[model samples]
Target: MLEQEKPLRLAAFDMDGTLLMPDHRLGEKTLSSLRQLAERRVTLVFATGRHYLEMKQILANIDIPGYLITGNGTRVHDLNGTLLHASNLPEESFKTLITHKWPTAASFHVFRDDGWVTNQDMPELLHAHQFSGFRYQLSELENISASGNSKVCFCAAHDELLALLPVLQTCFGDRLDFCFSAYDCLDVMPVGSNKGSALALLTDRLAISLSECMAFGDAMNDREMLESVGRGLVMGNALPQLKQQVAHLEVIGHCKDQAVSHFLQHWLNSPTLTYSPEY
Candidate 1:
């Protein structure tokens, strides 16, 4: 007798450029498809670099499922708002980042579930605030230093952010983790904390093997989770650098076209559909 294949037990998605459309809205078709997957008992998880509170508000209209691996995996919580796992960058590290005289023009923010704290006021920071829909407090880092924040972020011009990476890596690479959460934003978290680590811990608890899971993503921060899963599907709109960085990743439809939903529908309903790793 042939052995039964391990069923696809979980579907993980990165929000911004993987699941949500360019407008940052969940398309109705995608929502319906997600509901169908939920009904079939396929656990759906959203892993993002978003703050828990901001993600909560953004997903308020939809019944997004399973667990949220937020803050680039510094925090994880269940649908019921139960904290499953959490790791925060040390306060000293946060201070070190905030206090260091950045060689380039950059805006920084420290994030918690309730709100974010920032010491600088810049157009880029304001743009990020609008893009993320998270409120910020204009105060010294010391004022909010006591809060056990999940992460620290730096927003700068594209070129400036790229140039600042080497400096940051040389200075804080040993103590802190850095990920380009967006093209112009860098997120700093604790060492050994990332979306992939979060998924591994959650999967272990769920009694599912990594080979039984699939993940979708579109950015550098999503690399860990996307690469760790048995099947990693990136959006057509994913950054070119991200595409080149990971091996055996397949490019699916664009998020603007609701590729995730279409992919899920086809994946769940069609048995003959197969993934070709030769991208």
Candidate 2:
């Protein structure tokens, strides 16, 4: 196992595949574990590719308080919903994204400062965001400015997205970053923006170091944050490539089994839990 571990003062989690079940809802066990962590004085932070508003809806009835890193790191907010940092894409890059001719079946979603927008009707997307009650407004993406825009996403079949990935990289390689938040979702963001960078910013603001942080994730979008944390917990259901790369870290049980909750319970109950992560 990877040996580096300091006292964990902060814990970051990715939503969909890492912390949430396949149905995109947080279970009671996980919620209780997170609440216990906060009670122990550990600062809780959610580092997700999800939008802040959606996250708010997901955690609505619960009393769990935490910071949020949204838009795959384009926006960072504190517990009070205060904006700590924001990253915007360049206008030309935004223009390129809006004007690009995407695959006919691909549904495009954009997160802007004003509101969320989509190029077509994607009621299917609502299934995942049901807990959050956050929905996107349909638009032709015309007459929209880039001032507050941060992320653009395309959703299609897993294989279709795989085929389109290379084309996107070839065209906007240096200008933006593309990552798979899910098998079917390809998300694009400004260069240098990601969960890890945003996590670093949050930690810095909180007077903490990455060496004292623990984070859980399950996809390519979670890569940088996993690599940057003191202890990175890779889910058993993680992307094969990601699991292979972070094999040195703990490979927990499948998320559908509430693996994150199990780990947290162990950590909380372990008398040996200290500056080392033996879980």
Candidate 3:
């Protein structure tokens, strides 16, 4: 049996390669594990770069009661679809990005209590639909100059996104947070905003202590979250730098399917199992 000072109160999972399979589908094993965790009263939350609309489908498939930390950390919502909290970039930042000649096909997304708005044309909006659920409109960036934007995305090649980071940083500075959500997509949010901060806020509202929380991630955006949680798990496919920075090393399978579920089964079943570095 596992020695326990206290039972884990929460389990925050990063979507893409951490919880969902590469095809953006949830496997039966993963869903089963989630059900088990929920039954145990472990507050399961998702801290992902995806927005709520995009996350809803996956949540429906898994069928669990939990909070969502979407847009990296800009937006937080409850399982009942309540908007608990949100952070957004200033209008000036939006204008700057829209006016600037971004290498990739850039898009702007803004969220409020009701829903989100975007300033992309039809073709562009259709492309975004494949990734998120927010309604896309053809409002020009200048028209929404005073609008509050929750997140901005730039879609391009891997190397292209990397190259644009420095430029964006130089232009936006501490005004915005930037990271690649996928190989061809870069996510931007307000500074001082991230999955970790969102988790902190959610924990506070739920009256849960940081020490009682466990989080899983597999990307650079998840870095702060992994560092902030009590036990941060890094997936086997995480970047070398990300793996090196983790406080505790827990090896899990890749994002093919049920990797997280399998690991959790072993973990909860054998609490006495010790963790060792894979590298």
Q: Candidate 2 lDDT, tens digit per residue, 214-277? A: 8999998999999998889998899987888777877888789888988888777973664232
Alpha carbon deviation, residue 259, candidate 2 (Å): 0.5
My TM-score estimates for the predictions, one after another, are 0.90, 0.93, 0.85
Model 1 C-alpha RMSD vs. true structure (Å) is 3.2
Q: What is the C-alpha lDDT of each candidate?
A: 0.80, 0.85, 0.75
Candidate 2 lDDT at 200 equals: 94
| Tens-digit per-residue lDDT, 49-81, candidate 1 | 878887776666475566789988988887787
> Candidate 2 vs candidate 3: which has greater TM-score?
2
For every candidate structure, what is the RMSD over all alpha carbons to the true structure, in angstroms?
Answer: 3.2, 2.7, 3.5
Displacement of the residue 126 alpha carbon in candidate 1, Å: 6.7
Q: List the pairs of residues colliding in candidate 1.
A: none
Residue runs of model 3 more than 4 Å from their true location after superposition: 1-3, 103-139, 143-145, 275-279
Task: Please tell me which model should have the higher lDDT, number 1 or number 2.
Answer: 2
What order do candidates take by lDDT, descending?
A: 2, 1, 3
Q: Count backbone overlaps in model 2.
A: 0
Write one digit per residue (lDDT tens) for candidate 3, span 1-279: 112786789999998788877666667888888889999889999998776876776677556787899888988999897888888878787778767776555455555333555665546445434534445555656666456568877765667778888988988788888876666667887888889999999999999887788888888788888777778788877766577777465656687755788778876687676643321
Better of 1 and 2 by TM-score: 2
Residue pairs whose backbone atoms clash in candidate 3: none
Ten consecutive residues with minimal summed lDDT in candidate 2? 270-279
